[model samples]
Target: MLSKRSVAASVLCALLATGATACNGDKGGPAAASAPASARPSASPVPTLAVDTLTADQISEQAHAAMAALASVKVDGELTMDGSKLAVHLTSDKQGNCSGTVASPEVGQFELRHSGSKTWLRADETTWKKAVAKEPGATAQDAAIAAELFKGRFITGGDTRAELAEAAMMCNLIKGLFADDSDKGKEKIAKGSAGTTNGVKTFGLTVTTGDGENLTLHVATEGKPYLIRMEQTQGSEPAAFDFSEFDKPFTVQEPAADQVVDFSVFEKKVKKA
Candidate 1:
């Protein structure tokens, strides 16, 4: 019924009205309502630790008790170090024996006896006399080296006093015999499954030192914490002790009253070239 020009004008006006409505919606209408949902903040993904639930005093008490339990144990085991393998036995109570060959790549043979408080370092007769004359003290350093030499020549002079000190500290640390309780850190030694070696149920504890050394101490009984094995892997050297034999009826004797320990034997004097 309408002419072609009138029909084209009607369609153009309708399109312009629709575009204006769309523009207005974008500026401040339903489009703005949808924007807030996208811009809203997301939930956090980080996990939280429950450390706030524990106090420092509680941690210290736990650590001390654990160490005390460790110190009260006695153990005997085989010891291997520096390519030399030996039968190692130790008793925290009073007496034990370690008898083994020092091996090749080193010189000598050894049979060391420790009864009561006395330790006899019996070396290949040739080396024993040499050491008795060279080193003359009873300090831990001298005693450790002497113990090694008694078994053979696998030890060297460069083994520093610091190394001996560290060994002693490690031994005492496990025993909870710190000179100052404050020296102990807030690290707890954890207990693992019960293991049995030689028909004895052994309890295990693993401790990591401040310097990052990992050591495992195994005790054979709960009431009596006799050490059955010790494994250490901290530095370049891996050290361990395995208790293979136990003699319950063996007579335990004490060192003589007049016997003297010369710690000075561990001191090294520099000689002028």
Candidate 2:
């Protein structure tokens, strides 16, 4: 009976040791640790992009085509031209329809609603005062009166007047932005490192235009490789334009009858001032 008990105990000890060895082969199970080389999971492969291999100018041409195909987009930017810094926020289409605002130290701030041939502008008190004072022989009293009279009202007109024509042209803000002469000195274009803007991955192309302005154009890495943003960081007056809402449709409604004051009324008021 003693011999039988010893044999059974030995067998049990051997089984436990084998089980422990197999279970503790590594952090994972024995099969995983000792699996054939061909059976192991492979690392995920990185995706290849054709745009990444293209030349800087080729990439820019592609981006320009993408931008040109866009029917409408929301453009927001801080621009410096002729030593004046301006902030612009606009939702415009290729068809000359836009509703947005442009702000600057000289203009103060003004909102524009332009559709077809008509344009409506609503200027803040500072802008109203400035506009009134610009008229010939206008006094401070006139500026004050004009500012109060047109406060919170939009001045409407067709493209007949100079102010109206200029305001109406703002509907093509995107066109003016990416004009054909935008990058006249294309020979100086240099490819930049990959980065991201607003969570979208992009690669940049730095260029010095004919006007000597240094610009960095960031094009999206994925999808259609659209021009996502353009930044001017090299000059004394830094500026940036962020493009979004591609191909989105927007509408600009005419101001309410009571809220609108005709441009003739504004002109008469300024003349009296």
Candidate 3:
């Protein structure tokens, strides 16, 4: 039998897991039995989920379907690639619209926004200085001038620069993030026990990849059974990502004309230097 303290701790964990209120805080009692029927609180109807009875692979497929059905999603996580660490907080849609900040040790941090064929990039003085200094035959004077010219302004342009194109690809949540991993041809899928992610009750589906990496996907237990979080262990470094704001409406507004500079001008300046 669990002690009172243990029971209270479990209740607290459930209530605070998702950072949302999970219980009414009313202690169990018999007083409601004497109250009128109308005075009693209506019980919440239990949600019926088709994936509950399915195999682990089937549940993963359902979770992927739910994620694919969303119009947009917010992804926040850090990943390591080739020994370099990258952090990103992005909101992307299937229509190629995205707005987010990506940071890394090499390139510092930058804010990006994309809509249609236009893209806008903003960075601090140090980032601009480093970028300009990388150009062939660029001098310190040229780097300083580049930094001053682009400071406190956005570098806006079409999909002409390869670097910009790669950054903009982060907005493809459906193709890039919600991709079907079953085609990898070397993953073993298994069901995990019930758990909670950010306070939302979830059940996990763990996939052991060909490279011996373990990727655990957490699917919400309530409502639509949407994916709540994903955790991947690659060697010794672990990367975890949280998914939220599913199907929420968001607008990616272009920067004001006065606060923008064309990339062509910057490129020309650097080349002439």
Q: Relative to the unseen true structure, what is the C-alpha lDDT of residue 59 in candidate 1, on a scale of 0 to 100?
A: 30
lDDT of 2: 0.61
Per-model lDDT? 0.34, 0.61, 0.62
| C-alpha lDDT of residue 214 in model 3 | 78
Model 2 Cα lDDT, one tens digit per residue, 1-273: 223233222221221222222222211110001111221111234232366579888887777777777787776766555465666677898887998876667547778788888877787787766654444444576557657767898876556755466556656755665544544444478899887765566788987666666778878776666677777776555767677777766888989889887756644554443
Instruction: Candidate 2: list runs displaced more than 4 Å.
Output: 1-49, 134-136, 179-187
TM-score of each prediction? 0.37, 0.75, 0.76
Error of 1 at 49 (Å): 30
Candidate 1 C-alpha lDDT tens digits along 1-273: 433333322221221222223222211111001111111111244232122343433433443454344322223332333333333223332112222222111233333333333333334534433333333222333334444433432221122322222222212223333123542563456555566544445556676645555666555443233444556655443555543223223333433433322322222211100
TM-score of 1: 0.37
Q: Which residue pairs of candidate 3 clash?
A: 17-198, 17-199, 18-198, 18-199
lDDT of 1 at 66: 40
The clash count for each model shown is 16, 0, 4
Worst 10 residues of 2 by lDDT: 27-36
| Candidate 3: tens digits of C-alpha lDDT, residues 1-273 | 433333322321221221111011111000001111121111246463454588887887778787877788777766655455556677888787989876666556778788977777787888766554444444676657667877888876567754455556666665556664544557688999886676666788888767667788888766666777777765645566677777778789889998898766765654454
